[model samples]
Target: MFISETQIEVRYAETDAMQVVYHGQYVVWFEIGRTRLIKDLGFHYADMEKAGFVSPVTDIQLSYKRPFRYGEMATIRTWIQSHSGIRTTYAYEIVNETGDVCVIGSSVHTVVNKETFRPVKFKKEFPEWHAVYEKEKQGQ
Candidate 1:
């Protein structure tokens, strides 16, 4: 699998009263990782939006294994878990500087017309993007 890794410095704003990174922050990190993966694959999400299509999250799952503190460095690893004509699933793994896995997750998304909000087949609307996703998907 072609996994893209993005490093993030835990900020105080991302922490909670418990002094650990806020759980909700991981969701933002997931978006960062996914965006990096798409850039690494030579695609710009803005281009997709400019083309009048938007990929919206349809499902999401996350498992938190450990807590990280502010000022710590974390790496978010992301890859295409699966892809179909209509939907794509992206998997993620987050680890601390010491290389301990802190979180694992997946997000599913489907392309839709920006104005109509109607579902669109990725293979038909963005064949090049769909082809790269199919080629890099982790499993059948």
Candidate 2:
């Protein structure tokens, strides 16, 4: 359906002693992908926060296939896997320059009231964003 593509250049610091990307770095890359995808859909995380809510990662799963070396370019593909009133799930793929899939993952998030830290229905808080997510999620 609707997919967002973002490019990232691996940095030396992101690698380990073997010059391969450390296992933890993939999580950061996933965030980058999520941020781009939301922006591409015409919404801003900061604005969401300013509106008195925050979307926190409630769950995350990552799987590594091949190794990604430092200094290599990567294409991160991200999409909304599912979106409901209470939660949104996003899927991700990180591929190296050679078109090899380096990792696949997904993250689950839910919006919470900023001050109370209580879960809230996204559809009720942001109808426009919910509409966009509903349309894009249909493609998945």
Candidate 3:
């Protein structure tokens, strides 16, 4: 399994009135982690878009273990949990500087034709990309 790590600094705007990071910000962080993971695997999501395909999240699960405060640096760790022919599941872990896991989540996504919005099998549409995912996926 290949895990990608991205460091994000909690900003004041991302915090709630209590000065703790807002819950919704973690969803955005998941995207950041996912994008970084793809790039680290030598793939560009832009290329997928240019190919007239888009991967959209169909399911998402998140669990919050701790709260992050503004000015703290958090690490977002991402990896491919599993990948079917048409759907891919990505796992994420957000941790504080001390290595305490603050959040854990996963998102399921499927590729769809941009124009028709019909689901497409990743193996058929992007064989190379699919192959890499298959090889790198965790918990086989």
User: What overall lDDT goes with each candidate model?
Assistant: 0.94, 0.94, 0.95
The sequence of per-residue lDDT tens digits that candidate 1 reaches over residues 5-115 is 999999999999999999999999999999999999999999999999999999999999999999999999999988988989999999999999999999999999999
Name the lDDT value of residue 135 in candidate 1: 86
lDDT of 3 by residue, 85-123 (tens): 889999999999999999999999999999999999899
Over 102-132, each residue of candidate 2 has an lDDT whose tens digit, in order, gives 8999999999999999999898999999999
TM per model?
A: 0.97, 0.97, 0.97
Q: For candidate 1, what is the lDDT?
A: 0.94
Find the 10 residues in a row with the least total lDDT in model 1.
131-140
The regions of model 1 sitting more than 4 angstroms off are 138-140
True lDDT of residue 74, candidate 1: 98
Off by over 4 Å in 3: 138-140
Candidate 2: misplaced stretches above 4 Å?
none
Alpha carbon lDDT of residue 27, candidate 1? 94
Better of 1 and 3 by lDDT: 3
